[model samples]
Target: MLLPTLTLLTCFLLIVTLLPISNHTHWLIRGLDFPRLQIAIAAILLLIFQLIVLEITRPSSLLLICVSGFCLFWQSWWIVPYTPLFPREVKRAEKNSQKPSLKILTANVLTPNRNSQALISLVKQHKPDVLVTLESDQWWQNQLSVLEDDMPYTIKCPLDNLYGMHVYSRLPLTETETCYLVEDGVPSMHASVRLSDRVRVRVHFLHPSPPSPTENPESQERDAELIVVAKSIADSAQPIVVTGDLNDVAWSETTRLFRKISGLLDPRIGRGMFNTFHADYPFIRWPLDHLFHSEHFTVKSIKRMPSIGSDHFPLLTTLVFSPKAIPENEGIDASAEDRSRADEIVEKENVSKSEIPQPTAHAK
Candidate 1:
């Protein structure tokens, strides 16, 4: 009974594992991309039980063994970058460079989670140069306003909807704009942050919509919003860092496309998962928040912080501007086909207002 049950479970998991291989934008298909880590764990456990404990050497068992092994390898390959076994994507910041560094702290406060003390404590503990919070409402804004004294430069859009966002920075922020990138209610921030007289960096803070039954039924708009930002920027000269709760996993095809199109490198790659969502659930969580940067910078440190009474945890990343290190990191650029697909997403003619959002980028 146990052996037959195990085989059936293995087959079912395989189907879910392979479904996202196709470029389907449906919520169900895209949603499957989030659990690659969990799925890989399940496959490993099944393989161990079959070979070591169960030891059922029948022809059917042999087929299950092959399938289970393939699934494990496939998932691992997708997530290998997050493990130390893989080489770091962005080189570490060198000590002697002594370049100016910026520490950014981003957290999705889950809106209704009234406990601002945890987030406040984290900000005080880390003393980040920049602080960003998502799913924040007017109340949250009022609660966190205490940070204004130190982090004077601020950009805020506090809506009742789940997409409201706020950004606070200690450095001088110029040409800051609050934009409705794809959805009317969804807002994102773009600005130039001046680190010093000789050094300034372009920063984009985004909290794009996710594919879910209650929200977007498909991933089209979400994909389009990210592509718009990626396609608009030039990576070679200007130093750029994109951070926030992207509402998508780092390993998803859309995010990979964003990296290729924008020529940005993920610091989290070759680091760790830094899973930041579903803070209450141990078995179910994903790296929904992200920080991606151009080759002009090197990572000092990137980590996931402790919980703050919200459904999501905080992410802290410190980067030093070091254009010389650019050559050490391999750049990922979009192929001709990748550009075409990105064009289709951003400029699809048949898209509805709700599904296709015109990305607004400006300086004020």
Candidate 2:
């Protein structure tokens, strides 16, 4: 009984460590930002393996442990594709007194979550120039209507499905386009708003469901959509900001690639990775929400707001636009070779016959 109880305790510890691994996998499969989750899982796995070896001694139980270890090791491969190990520093851009400006906020209010009051409180407190919400239903739409007086400019598409999205802006919206980047009905909101100085800034709000048996066959579509957006931003000369519950993490390979491809900067690097999802489970959380920007803006501050009933914690960021030129090496500069390699990877991943890449032997 002592040995059995010890084994059970060991197994429980291993399982607890593995649960975050599963959550990280779920986030990655969904094309969401969740690198912190991946890192936590990696740390936990390291500790678990050490404990397993120290505690298990019986042959039958050891064999069972070994098998479980093998499966756990196998699962690490899913995380291998997304890990962002490179350290990136944030360098504040020189402020220019001449430029017009804009401020934005993005959140994913989990539709079933009844924390409408908490969410409302957050909105009232922050008072961002623009507010975008995903997973909004009619009820949420109604609940959020109180903000119409302040955020008079708005575009709402609330639905019963969690995918219902909305955008409200304080700036004058010159044009707005609702685009379907991947699956039908999964819309991405795009708008051009005139800032206080009459400068136009392009803002895009996206929330694509990751690859899952129920939501998608694979993550290829989600990845491709992100890549497409990256390509568009790369081509644009305008100051652009992309914000939403990206369902991806700041440090993931895909996000890094997206930043490189789109010439965008992340506020998290040099600051901190603000883990936003699974608000109820502080020990097992990751940053699945994000705001990526072009070089025209410098982040003043960014933070994770208090839990507002949803599985995700709302993210608030304040950025000041600066016409200051980015130092040659400080900004994203994907060379021709890099772009070619990235394009090939994207193409391969999007191919219908392709299988998700397996974890390397070293990763295991």
Candidate 3:
């Protein structure tokens, strides 16, 4: 009876595990992508118990154990990149180099979170060169406006739909625009920031809609929106940075594709998960807030800041641009097959509307 129960549990996890490996972007399959770490841990515990506690296993049970171990190993392969045991996707900045750096603090304020003081305090402490906030309404805007004196380059879209976004940068900004790429109300920020020595770093900030029962029933729009952004930035020559709550886990296939298509590296790789969401429930958290940069940049530091009365924690990252370090880091080379998959994903939905306006002539 115990063996049967164990088998049933293993089978259930395996079903959830294998479902996400498919190319389909339905919410049911895509939702399982978030808990791969938890599932992997469970698999490891089950395998250890079966090996040590169970004895004289039947041939059928033996096969089940083998499958359990296989699943555990598979899950670990995806997670190992995000652990210190594996090498980082982006190299750390060398102390001797005098490369100019940019510090950014990106947070999702949950729209309804009224405690703007906490977020303001964190911003004051960090003193980031750029600030990106998602799900922010007019009240959040009013509260956050205190920092405008320091960061005058601004792009604001305050909406009540919980998809509002705002970006403020201390550095000079050009060609700044808020684009509604996927849904009618959803907005993303695109601009270029001029750093020291007149270097221009192209920036893209997105808060893609998540696949959920209340907000969005399907993951198709989210996946398509990400693919569109990835494809657009694939061939850009300037140093690029993309940040925001992607609403997708780092290990998901779509995210992996995004990394390949954009040729951007994740600082969280080979470090820690830096789980930022569900801050109220410690156990149910995942790294939803993300920052991905082009090959020209290397990490100075990346940290998860303390909660500011919101369900999500702000991510603070400092990066230094280094074109010479590209050869030392790892990059994913997308194949013809990968391009075909991306094309198919983009074609599935008719995403043809943008409310983005031309940048002010002086800002440009």
Candidate 4:
């Protein structure tokens, strides 16, 4: 009993202390493979294990206090190492003078969240060149239709359920397709658009379900879908940008691998995490929403917008394609080594199309 209790306590301590460790170590996070949903389940399992094996006692209480103290100390130092510093090698792209900038706004408008007016107000304020919304239902879609006139190019799949995703762009959409990256009905939008300069860029908008007992019990589908997109980006010749809720954080292992695999750069790393999930809660937050860009582009700016009605705060990023060289220290170098590592990780975890489990009706 005492052993199990100590073991459970140790597990909790490790989870809390090592949580920050995940931000820096890509392999640890990706290979472990379970989504954030598993973290909650692991917590429950620890509690049950402790209750069944050990009797609560003064010593256990003291041990927990010590563990708490350790967690605090660990957290204080853990954050320092993972803090993103602007890479010293960032340089002005020589091509910035020639190419027009692309500004994008992405938001997860929670289904049943009826603050479309606030969202509209935000869009009016930002006036981004492109807008993408997740978890948008028919009602929400109708409300957003006002933008169709100004934002002539649009692709919408507004489901009553949370899987609904939409994209509205000011640029001419040359090619567009709605794809099911993982399960049936879980749609992701892909498109090629001609910017004002006539430069063609491919964009993929994704919103994979977070791992949960209600949704997927495993992270296989989410991880696989992400890998597929990453590989596509790697293979794509056109300048590419990916944006959406992602339902994962910038610091997570999967995201890092995706960045490396796709050779996409995240402006948020040295700038700030800009945690977007659980918008109402200030403390228990993570950067679940994101924007990733190919090396051809340089970030003009990125920000987290004020909340409308969803659990997630919106994200806005402006990128300009520049032919100039980037500094080596600005972030990560998408070197051959990094790319090779990323490819290996993706190939090793490449689950076949037949293997992905279908989402149950209840799961939706």
Per-model lDDT: 0.86, 0.67, 0.85, 0.68
Please give the RMSD to the true structure for each candidate, in Å. 3.4, 8.9, 2.7, 9.1
Model 2: per-residue lDDT, tens digit, 1-364?
6556545655654555455433233433334334334444654564465456555565766655564555455445434433344344344444554445455667788999877888778888888888889999899999999988988888788877678899887777656777665667777777776675545677778887766667766656666666667776776667778888876666555667688888887767756667788888877777788888777676666778888888888888877666564452155577786587457655754532122111111100
Superposing every Cα of model 1 onto the true structure, what RMSD results? Answer: 3.4
Q: Provide the lowest-lDDT 10-residue window in model 4.
A: 355-364
What tens-digit string does per-residue lDDT give for candidate 3 at 94-115?
Answer: 9867877889999999888898
Candidate 3 ranges beyond 4 A from true positions: 351-364
Report the candidate with higher lDDT, 2 versus 4: 4
Q: After superposition, how far is residue 348 of candidate 1 from its true place, in Å?
A: 2.7
Model number with the top lDDT = 1
Compared with the true structure, the alpha-carbon lDDT of candidate 1 equals: 0.86
Model 2 segments beyond 4 Å from truth?
1-89, 93-101, 335-338, 341-364
lDDT of 2: 0.67
lDDT of 3: 0.85
TM-score of each: 0.93, 0.73, 0.95, 0.74
Q: Could you tell me the lDDT of residue 322 within candidate 4?
A: 64
How many clashes show up per model? 1, 8, 0, 9
Arranged by lDDT, best first: 1, 3, 4, 2
